[model samples]
Target: MTDENARHAEKMKKIKAARDRMMETKTEEKGLIMVHTGPGKGKSSSGFGMIMRCIAHGMPSAVVQFIKGNWDTGEKTFLRERFADEVRFFVSGEGFTWEVQDREKDIAAAKRGWEIAKEQILDPEIAFVLLDEINIALRYDYLDIDEVVEFLLYQKPRMTHVCLTGRNAKPELIEAADLVTEYTLVKHPFRDGVKAQKGVEF
Candidate 1:
């Protein structure tokens, strides 16, 4: 063959091989639920780490701070300034359950926050959702486990990711989750009358 014809033939062979490889490789999308529980300080911290990882990969994330509505964590402030519209954070006006003791009011606040959570959980743009302290709310009967599970199963966008953190995680949640981490409390500063610090515990 002539030089021009030989060059064209080589280009055609390369194109054919590329087409075959593209046909052979395929990608499937799926979602995941990660639970961080047990009596420790890093449950929410772990969830936030996952959020940062997702964002680093150009994935959007949302955070729903349930029981810790009033207490301002550094993560919340950082997210507010950096991500702003990308992260959706909803905090109930009422603080902790022990402080409130108003069953009706606490439930009402949780339900409202859960409704907002439901929206964030289903949104396709929100690749990862940090449900900070959600397991504790479920354990305390502030939210319905079945309802949350059903929503996780049904409402999640294709390839969406979820992270839940709190203590005393129920068996059902553990079973439903793809990854579960239990942070055992071997040692903590709070036991020695150390109050929650600004950047650490808040």
Candidate 2:
């Protein structure tokens, strides 16, 4: 073989060995509290991706949408229609806070959503729970952050993976998360006068 090809092979061998060693160190496994937040999009989308993974494994999962109303979306429709037996979906919000324009109503909806989330989290049969857009409710003080965090960190089932998605996640929630991903908004189509497209923004 050429000298360049020989050098490339040598470098890959070292990388594989290092990766194997690092993977070996990761032996302990437990349910993870994951937070997906920031100004960018895809927070809820990413949470759904995890739910799809759970479905692929035949693991039962549940979703409690805290801020989005009963709007038609591809993920919602597909999951509910195709995987009804493995996924339990709930939409607890009437609409966005700006649209609802009633603090009392928003709070009531958030509380109702939280109750549903708690049920899913505590269910041993459920392996994954997605509390979609729950950070918005927490940000607006529609729900008690302390109570939510306490229950998630202490009272959740040992093998249940819970994901919280939205912007402006509480500091306490971030501190309690086992995995956190912040979606940075470098650019967006909305700013360019492009409306949200089906299968992309919904």
Q: For this target, which candidate reaches the highest lDDT against the unseen true structure? A: 2
- Over 57-148, each residue of candidate 1 has an lDDT whose tens digit, in order, gives 88878888888877767888888888776676677536778888888888888888788888888777788888888876898888999999
Cα lDDT listed for each candidate? 0.82, 0.92
lDDT of 1 at 113: 77
Give candidate 1 misplaced runs (Cα > 4 Å): 1-29
| TM-score of predicted structure 2 | 0.97
TM for every model, in the order presented, reads 0.81, 0.97
Instruction: Please give the lDDT score for candidate 2.
Output: 0.92
User: Model 1: how far is 66 from its true place, Å?
Assistant: 0.8
How many Å off is the CA of 44 in candidate 1? 0.5
Backbone clash total, candidate 1: 0
86-142, model 2: which lDDT tens digit per residue? 999998998778987999999999999999999989988999999999999999999
Off by more than 4 A, model 2: none
Model 1 TM-score relative to the real fold: 0.81
